[model samples]
Target: MKRQHSHLTPHHPLSGAETTAAEIVSGVDLTGRRAVVTGGASGVGVETARALASAGAEVTLAVRDTGAGARTTEDITATTGNQGGRVAHLDLADQDSVAAFVSAWEGALHILVNNAGVMASPELRTPEGWELQFATNHLGHFALALGLGPALARDGGARVVAVSSSAHHRSGVVFEDIHFRRRAYEPWSADGQSKTANVLFAVEAAKRRAADGVTVNALMPGGIRTDLQRHVSDAELARLRARAAGGAELEWKTPEHAPDPEAAALLWQDSQDTLAAKG
Candidate 1:
């Protein structure tokens, strides 16, 4: 079978264009669409929710802090004139919370954006005994996407966007000793693994749900200073930049190699088992 590609080309109007989410969907109206943006309480997540709502989509800000979520939802509603903006509680680090959020979700979902993440934190493990970064950044979103599979499959179709990072280029999934049991726990390495998992999760989910009209994709939204870097010190940031500069030549990723079928399958199965074991 030949490879399928997106209609968007390098010469497309949005191609090579630095644009805001609101501007990108300017002409496209999403009047009846419903979207869920995790971590939509602040930073890029906030802007994303606002943009989608501005485009006439009913956007739910899934946040860990209900207080912040409510405030963000209010702000979004006030700015977009779309009263559909609402807030819901979601703590990705907790599987029970993820399940609860899914259970409370209603109606068809037009879009799901896995936008929450943590970066460069000191070695720590979640209550589930998994590495904190890997568990929250990757597995949590993995469960969220699958849990919402039915919702996403409804209402014609749905798009799932996994917000990965260029940091994935630094490392691939480390199946062996994934929790840093055998080796020393390095923050960046764990983060890279999580980001790579995000890409793989998107690829595999897209493949599995394509028959149901659900599309999944992953992207790196460039470097932006956000709450995600709360754990990193200024000195650490400088050191990170210096390390990146001295590393191998950076290569831009193309959609051509975005979905690695084999890796996708491995990740999918791994995620399923991991989640099941936790349950």
Candidate 2:
């Protein structure tokens, strides 16, 4: 009922349908917004797609797999009463996939939700030699945004929500050795580097496009047991799920508890624009 930028999203409990960020946007009508979500077939991505379609926004799910996306798209249509959901092939690991996706997209764009990410996994690199986490989590989205700069600009204003992480505070961006060329690579170290890149990318993009109406903001998705941790061992997951003070160890939110993917589109609406997505 009330909106305050200073008041952070509360996490004690979810009462009504709007309790979560995605749920809060369930009632919102994004009848004209066009959105793209990466790695959106499972976990928080599902909730993200559901909320946007529920709000009437045309959603393009960029995934590495299409079969899995069919299931996700069906669930979205079932919940939203809209068929604006479509799946587009995207392998953040491949530059060709990124390039092809950008080349084919047409019309006025409204929102870009950089929700795709790779978590603590083994060290690897893309074809171009960029580190895995930094590549998929940061560079891929960076390229996608820059590629679609025209669409975002043509619309006059657009919203770019970069889903960063609390892990960012663990370490800042490693400018000189982003690829850890000089150090032995660790899983969490890569994850932290990727998260830090998320924030830095957002801050830089926001500054560059502020005059063009592309207001970028980064926020932590809070702790949730999403498939992003599938690479984690069973024992590691058990520890994270364990409760310490007679309750949950992390006070973590469920997939539903994570911020709704559509909230950005709704909250940015103002008296001046007929559009739902604002830069």
Candidate 3:
């Protein structure tokens, strides 16, 4: 299938499952670059921050748990010997927290990693009545990126990485009932919809921000057991493990299957409207 964006080049030879983050960025210099990784206190977020810091980027961990963020900062600094590591509080589910973080940010931002997310959680909602997964995984990151647009565009060649998942193939955005107002809540379906939104956000943001030299993309970090799976039961975990052992191939959704330009635009507008209404 034809790709819609020029930036969607073929995968790099080094991007295989065995490739580590450190290896991907080996010998690369980011001496004066500034980066922020949401949920940088744990999981892949910690590793991402460490790798960026190792590359000499001034890294900030935007996390809800400042204590954990501080601990991660120290660990990264100790491991990388890069004193530029810092931590700031950010709760993606809270618009005010996102706004404050954006407002507090200074100067150009070379990289923003939308890495924090909840998975397969029980039914939950934000103050605005938005589903918890969608709110944090998509809309919160959406607002953060939008708010930081100027900072991101200040210097050419800024990058925004949205951590989506292969699970996006499970479901597309249900515009009619995104928050499950009428529809019954199902954990994985909500997660899939939100993950799809992450991709759509990248698609639309890339198109709109291309003129600003801001590159946006989504990635599926192949199944690693992380705290993100905290909500899964033992039975479900065992089933997933069995499936993985069976060598089940992950079929990613094609652009034709979902995340079309029209859908992207509609989602962007709807997200804007939703946030505005809440305000």
lDDT of each: 0.82, 0.71, 0.88
> Residues 40-123, candidate 3, lDDT per residue (tens digit)?
999999999999999999999999999999999999999999999989999999999999999999999999999999999999
Candidate 2 lDDT over 27-52, as tens digits, reads: 67789889888887977777877888
**CA RMSD for every model?**
5.1, 10.0, 4.1
Best by lDDT: 3
**Candidate 3 local Cα displacement, residue 144, angstroms:** 0.4
Rank order (by TM-score, best first): 3, 1, 2
Q: How far is candidate 2 from the true structure (C-alpha RMSD, Å)?
A: 10.0
Error of 1 at 2 (Å): 30
TM-score of each: 0.89, 0.78, 0.92
Judged by whole-model lDDT over C-alpha atoms, candidate 1 comes out at: 0.82
Point out the worst 10-residue segment of candidate 1 by lDDT.
3-12
> By lDDT, is 1 or 3 better?
3
- Pairs that collide in candidate 3 are none
Off by over 4 Å in 2: 1-18, 240-279
- Ten-residue stretch with the least lDDT total in model 2: 270-279
